[model samples]
Target: MISINNLTFEIGSRALYDEANWHIKPGDKVGLIGANGAGKSTLLRLIVGQYAPTSGTISMAKDLKIGYLNQDLLSYHSDKSILYVAMEAFERQNQLHAEIEDLLAKLETDYSDDILNKLSDRQLEFEALDGYNVEFKAHEILAGLGFSEEEQKRPLATFSGGWRMRVMLAKILLQTPDILLLDEPTNHMDLPSIKWLENYLQAFDGAIVIVSHDRYFLDRIIKKTVESRKGKLTLYAGNYSFYLEEKELRNELQANQFKNQQAKIKQEERLIERFRAKASKAKMAQSRIKALDRMERIEDVDDDNPTVNFSFKFSKPSGRHVVTLDHISKSYPNLEILKNTSAIIEKGDKIALIGANGKGKSTLLRIVAGADNQFEGKSEHGHNVSQTFFAQHQLEALHLENSILAELQAFAPKHTETELRSILGCFLFTGDDAFKKIKVLSGGEKSRVALAKALTADANFLALDEPTNHLDMQSVNILIQALQQFEGTFIVVSHDRYFLDHVANKIWYIEDKEIKEYPGTYQEYEEWASKRLVKTEVKPEKKVKEEPKVKKEKQAPSEDRTRLLSKKNKELSTLEKKIEEQEISVKDLEQKLADEAVYSDATKLQETTRAYNSAKAELTHYQEQWEQLAEEIMELEND
Candidate 1:
């Protein structure tokens, strides 16, 4: 329930919004859609009073609770657990709870009439604000956002950028505000988590104004679409799909009107040119010119045509088999992710790795790409295999000092400047954008540049993890098309449902520490999963157990699968012990280094320093190996 009347917001010389009149009615789940700099997020900021509009008014109902979530998670709270951070959304209620506690404590010693009155007032406020259900609601929101119960207890500072965003999102949702202003809320969420958010938002009370590039997310949640362009806010009375359809029709009509007006003006201009010398026709020509000049001209609608075209420059093909995993069992000291999982990737396979968050999809991809070799698995690459690996953190690996063009040229030294620019254009980096330093680029821009670099690299095997995470719908479509046409073997780990369905011929569903390959697109896999979910399960009930279900290892410990699992577990245990011993040695060496007696004796100091340095180096080595094992185990446990 917000209203904007004659709103004008300017940034330096540019007016982002010009005399815009808009009404955000009650229960309006609005998707704010526009180009990168078209002020979608700016609108949210203006509404939230982050910055004042140059003119006009954005008025809302009195005392409206507004929860605003933008890109503001950079400031880390070192001591706050994820749960505590989320629970802080109920700040007012929490304060009341604390005040009530203080009052109760005061009553234990001595109580006055004023103190008792204050306590009742505070308790009433807490009850009114649902203070008792605060923790439960916080946990529910956190869990929906993919944070595990254990992860909830972890400090907020320990998480990466994506996870930290989830924590922020959980905080916003837990606030239960009357209005939610979220900008790119699903940017860091996995597919399942995105789905969970969509479901949550569907039933969310209050008004919602979201700015996102996720088409599917908007389609599922938004009821009204608001598009901003050229300092105008245009409303469409439907979802994203309906917006697209209606926009096309409106543009076509506008184009026709503009064209017709142009044709009539051209005719009038030609008439004036032809009959100006003739006095007889001069009168008629002057009248026609006056009429033409008086007519209001219709401007052409803004074009959103995506001009993207590119192809992957794959080198010679690899052998018939691209890569193979033989009885692979990757584990950490705490958990096992892949338990004797085996899969053969062929030379022409376009596999989409699909699963919930923390599944071994990305790990398995890295293992195959030869980026991570610590896992206990027999992974073999076929003959003449040339691979380009794009991890989800691929943007972080970019050379920030170099310009986008320079970065590309560094990777492809032989390619001409013109050719590099052309490929960059296909990825939406055009003209002067090619010269932009990677350090100055936004997250989405960095992602696009990374994608451009990966696609342009001379490789026959591509291992991309979440490649479409920051891509817009148009860019994603282009990427899908390019990947489809590329004559190379690729394994892509992605959560974008449309991208997966379009580009993948084989689906690898990694669940329960095993890879189940299906010979169909992701859509087909979804259909199969849906049917399986509805199928009657045969396991005995926990309350009334009729019989025990069969365990399907197919053999005893004599089997190779069993032996492989045993070996993996043994390796994990050994690595853990080795790391622990090394850590102790490092700590002991540090203690020796700290001793004043060792420093006083020069020879003893030198000896102790050498021992300390050597132990620290050895400890670092053991810790790395231990980490890889622990990472796999942690993933499996979380999954």
Candidate 2:
């Protein structure tokens, strides 16, 4: 547990935290949210003692342990295996094991009681600390973070910065500190690893403070939301969604108060003017004016959520089919990315390509963008299909010497400076900010500039790879709104579920070296995929043998017909009731799939998916039975 009281942190003349106070209680799952420059990461650094507060206190429990994960860990490198690095969290256990090994080696030369006694002591300590299972725990955490068994054994130095960051995350998770301070922990993660981390954090026994731009991730795991805005930390009792609603309500209340105050001031001003004209009330007017001057003013709410008023347009519309891949086959050494995979991108299609990491989502995007020609396939673009490709590398492609406005001007030569600035305004770069050099911008700012450039190109088709990578929640919403209003075709690759759900009308995923399409929103695709997963996991049941039927005794035709009709009607009634109940069950399961708690947990998702699938099957069977019974009764009555 940690307590931050009246914290005032200043960087030069600007204060990031001005008398901000927050208490992170034991077992609290807090989501630290704000705009990109609102000091979320800086607060994390202050909590971990990397940066000292200018005033006030950040106090922690005497025995409380904290683990902080930040982007700076990307610079970490080790020649040792990542598994070994992660297991280093068990410092005492590792030390005991080393001593025990040393003692065993000594025993080969001399069998003294002291040596034997030391070995026995070390072994006891190792067993007590559960030293033997350290490797297994390390391996599990590493694998969950997306490192394979073989990859875990590879030297940490061989991995890229993002992969190394994941290894650091694994190390922090293995440590299981009493409290965790994670800043953008989902930055380098894929959807699968992000889900795995969500489940892990949901079950974590310690307090957690996460600063993430991922809305879906925050909604899934965090119970409390803390917004860092205007140099103050405001707490919300619920998750990100709840924070948005609560903030809107507070803003409305503040706006009303401000309006009432302004009206009262105006009425008083008119009275003062009248009183000043009369000698008798001049003194009273003077006193009232002084009181009014001393009164505290109410500040009106600022508009934080800016709307995207700029519409995206292209010079010429593409043909019906924007792009086509004919039997595309691409492979790398010991890895088959895609084989005989064929797909089409229509002019109006808004596709979201998503899956786990190393699944070639980016590669396929490149193939569609025509950036890569080494793959064996006929990738054809429809007539008038002008395309713009945006990827992480585009950030590096930006000219460091040019201003943001100048950069846009160069990328879109046809657009006037006014039009380019208008597009930049939608991306949150205002009048003077647009004139700032690209080198002076932060990672998120640079990403916004790059995104704005991509949108400005008069292309009918867009292939965006991780376009929301460094954007804040507000910026992401802007991009979402722009894409929603876009009239051209696009296929985007992103791991942000919330962004995808809002921007994509169709889902594309690669499975077994083939591209699969789900013609619905991301949420719909997830529910369907869950059922498909359950189906694959379930085994077939053996057929039971049926006994020979016994013939009934002969009866009067009228009586037999009446009895058969009655039986059929009763069965039909029962089937109808069952069908109704199954429908309810299916609806309930669908609701559960939409619930954050159910979808965030693997066990719950699996259980709910299985139940949903079963309910659907039962509903089908009952409907069939009802129809058969109804037909039989109709036939009997007619006879």
Candidate 3:
């Protein structure tokens, strides 16, 4: 759909891409990946016409629609509801609605055949585009993106920059252009919302050229990987995993070749040095010199920025059942985010609390950690559940007037400057960087400082909300590993799929105003939730008849397509209804399991847990069956 020919983008005395050529064809889900300063986002901007390349050209198919989700939110006019902003994407549909409304008013005044004909055309166009269902589709998109119905009604200006980015994302999605240019699109999203986006893109027929640092998201969605580095573009035929393996092999091959060349040169240099001193071997010495001169030197491959390595260790351990919420509920005058939700967090639980934005995930964390007391929740802290809360907004709590070194000192006053600076180095803050004032640090830098402070604190229970927001990929990995190894219990509210899958043994899915706990990784949760009831009803399209110009006779299907499609469709519908009923049954059983009376009876508790788990497994089994049936239906229809 788009082409980049001999592209060369430079920034005064520095070149990001030079003579780089790449083509983006239809149905290609390409992951544009590189380090932080590798110009990935800049390249997206160049493609979107925000900034022109220094040289070369980016061309797209004529009149093709291209939707772009900028890494940074663009400025807008006065306050508008999120729903209104998202609906703005369907420009034609909205315009048609307005026109139809105006026409209806005009008809009340007076009407003619000319006006009637115009109204008919407009109505046909509206119906053709499914304009009547725009509101329902918009609402679904908003809800999938993690905005509650009430939150959707709020003015756009009321949201933070991150949430506002979601609104922009919703806008681009509703557009459904031929090509989608998303730059770090998952930056502000939570885990559940990211999953929704993954499913959204999975069904999207258009090509996607995305620049993202999110590893798991890329691994799941991207079919081709493009690495931009050192003024060059490297293309991989497969996903990020394939790219990693191929890059490693290429590096090793180059290293071996480089070593062999160096060895040959050393041998030649020694021979020449010995022969040069002896006139008897003058010819040999000359030959060695020529060989050395003709030898092609191997290029040294070094990373532009060194990877940051760090680990966090807890100073103490929290008691078993570190925090527990009994009959907790939260409401913001108009919206009740949570309702009588109860959970018991144990020590070393390593829970990943995932949900859409503004769904009480943060509120629950605050309530449990005793950070917010206004909520209606009976939170019981176990013996010495000393809490350490880390949030994106809490970075402001750091004294901007103080230097990073000074901040760490405040966390651990006993640690000397040398010790504190060493720890700072692990977080990518070195010598002079350690001395930099907290006031001058970027959001990412401040996040690192806040994390450094939190890690050093003498707390056992950690309540982290979007902790990896500002950290780079390497830092995220390191933090995940550290959390995995940490002795204390922690509840991390993050959208990082890889981090969540690797770190959290338990997932608390907060959705539909309820907290449902699942004892598994995010991937496992996906395996369980993949059971969306399939709709099997298929309507035949209006097929055009052929003209009589040596036309061949059409053969009717002899029990090949229609019957098989109908059978699979019927089976899928039945299984879907059954699964829906099974889900409800499991929910009731789960509620029973949560009852104090059930737990009081040990036999009943065991039976209920086993039954609930089995019922849940059965639901997934039915979903698997539906998946197979759907596949069969698609195959028959395609054939």
Candidate 4:
């Protein structure tokens, strides 16, 4: 539905895209992938018309609706409830409904045929747009995005940035635009909500273009992958995993070709050098030199970034129990974030906290770390625990004016100038980079600095919240390696599935106002979660049967007709109840099949699908029995 012809976009002397041609057809779910600074978000803005290409034509069908969700958006503040904001997407439907109502009011008096015809047209348009279910649809969208009914009634200003983003997502989903351009849509989402979004997009009819770092989300939802590299776009069929394998193979081939070309060039140069010393072979040598000059040299691909390597060396070991929380409960006025929460962090334990955006995963982390104490709980740390807590808002707490080196020096007072500089260097702050003021650092740079500071402390236990937020893939791997090697206890709250899958030894799922521990990796947690959800949805089918006494009386009635009728009535009531239970079972199985997480698990998914089918078959059997019983009951009543 949208086409870009010979697109060229540049920022000052840098060219983001040069003569790039691309097209997005209807129902295309494309994942935009690129390295840091590859202009993925910039291209998204270009497609949405937020930024005009320096040169090229972007053509789309006239009047085609498009929705763009940018990373940076103004906080929506109004007295209107969240539901009202979501319902705003169907403004046309609302307007048509209002017009219909006005027309009906006018119909009470003498109205012209022309007015009546217009009213009829408006009514038809409203009905065609599903105007009657606008509110219901809006509510569904909100709930799918993880908003509770009470939250729906809350004002927009009462929510935090992450919650506000969910509201925006709800608006976009409810709008159902012809094309959706989303940038890091899962940035503020938890595992469960991310699952919801995946299902929503999988069933979405319109084309979708997303820029995200969440591999699991993309792998499950997107069918096509578009990668930006070296001022060009490469399209790959299939999901993120497919793209990864293809890209690796392609890069290896390119590297081999480059090496071969370099070897040939060197060989040619060596032959020319030897022949140049001989007067008789001077012409041949000159000819060879000209060939070397004219030959197009293959450019070598840039090497991957160096990994940030570090090891924690503690002076003394902490007690067996690093930290413990007892009956922790926190609430903010009307919102109860955490209640009766208890967890124990032992030395050498790596734990991952998982939940939806507003489920207070971070809050729980903070409470455990003793950073926030406005709660009714006893949080105790082991002797000489030496704890370090990394909050999501750590960057805001930094002294921006201090140089990176100075910041580290202030945190590690015992370290010499050289020691501090060496520590900063490990985090990519080299030479003058260490001297740069923190205020001028990029988001990624600031994140690195914060992480460096957190690690510099001789803390045996680290509590990090979204530490991988601004880091690139390379940096994330480096941090993962560092954390994996550390002997200290680690409790991190993050949404990056890959990171969690690689580093976490245990998964803590926070849901339904409680925390449940899963003693396995993220993949295992996913499997367990899928099975649990299916079991939760599978209901027992109810059975219906005719009363034995009524059945016997049908063959030999006459004087006992009233007794048979009473028995028949009782049997009918029992059959109705049984049918109702069977119906509930069928609905439960259907819900299980429709759940997103069930589809995410490859192994359990097949089992769940089979189970769902079996349940459906069982339901059908009960349905047939119910029908037969109904017929028999009807005959008895007529008699």
Clashes of each: 1, 0, 0, 0
Give the alpha carbon lDDT tens digit for every residue of 364-467 in model 4. Answer: 88887888889987889988898889976889988999999889888988778877777676676778888899999888889989998898888888999999
Residue pairs with colliding backbones in model 1 are 332-629
Candidate 3 pairs with clashing backbones = none
- lDDT per residue as tens, model 3, 111-157: 89877888899999999999989889899999998898998999999
- Best TM-score among the predictions, by candidate number: 2
Off by over 4 Å in 2: 540-639
Residue-by-residue lDDT tens digits, candidate 1, 1-639: 899999999999999999988899888999998888888888888998988999999998789889888877646566689999888888898899889999999999877898899998999889998899999999998898888999999999999888898988888888778989988888767888998999999999888998887777899899999988888899999999999999999999999999999998898898899998899999988898889878998998865755555556765779999999988888777868798888899988999988877877778888888887887769999998888998757788899999999999999886889889988988888899999999999877898898888888888999998898777766787787779888989999987887888999888877778887766678767765665565425322432553332343223434565565566667788977887898898888888878898888999999999988998888788766754554444333322
Q: Report the lDDT tens digits of candidate 2 across residue range 1-639.
A: 688999999999999999999999999999999987799999999998899999999998787889899999988878999988888889898889889889999999989999999999889889888888989899898999899989988999999888898899988988889999999899978999999999999999999999998999999999999999999999999999999999999999999999999999999999999999899999999999998999999999999998999878998999999999999999999999999989999989999999999999999999999999999978999989999999999899999999999999988999998888889999999979989999999888999999999999998899999998989999999999999999999999999999999999889899889997776689877876776567557623311222222123133456767887888778877877888888998998999999999999999999999989988988998876765565456445433
Error of 1 at 544 (Å): 5.2
Q: Model 4, residue 498: displacement in angstroms? A: 1.9
Q: After superposition, how far is residue 296 of candidate 1 from its true place, in Å?
A: 3.2
Reference-based lDDT, residue 565, model 4: 69
In candidate 3, clashing pairs total: 0
Q: How many clashing pairs in candidate 2? A: 0
Q: Give the whole-model CA lDDT for all candidates, comma-separated.
A: 0.84, 0.90, 0.82, 0.82
RMSD to native for every prediction?
21.2, 12.5, 15.9, 15.2
The best candidate in terms of lDDT: 2
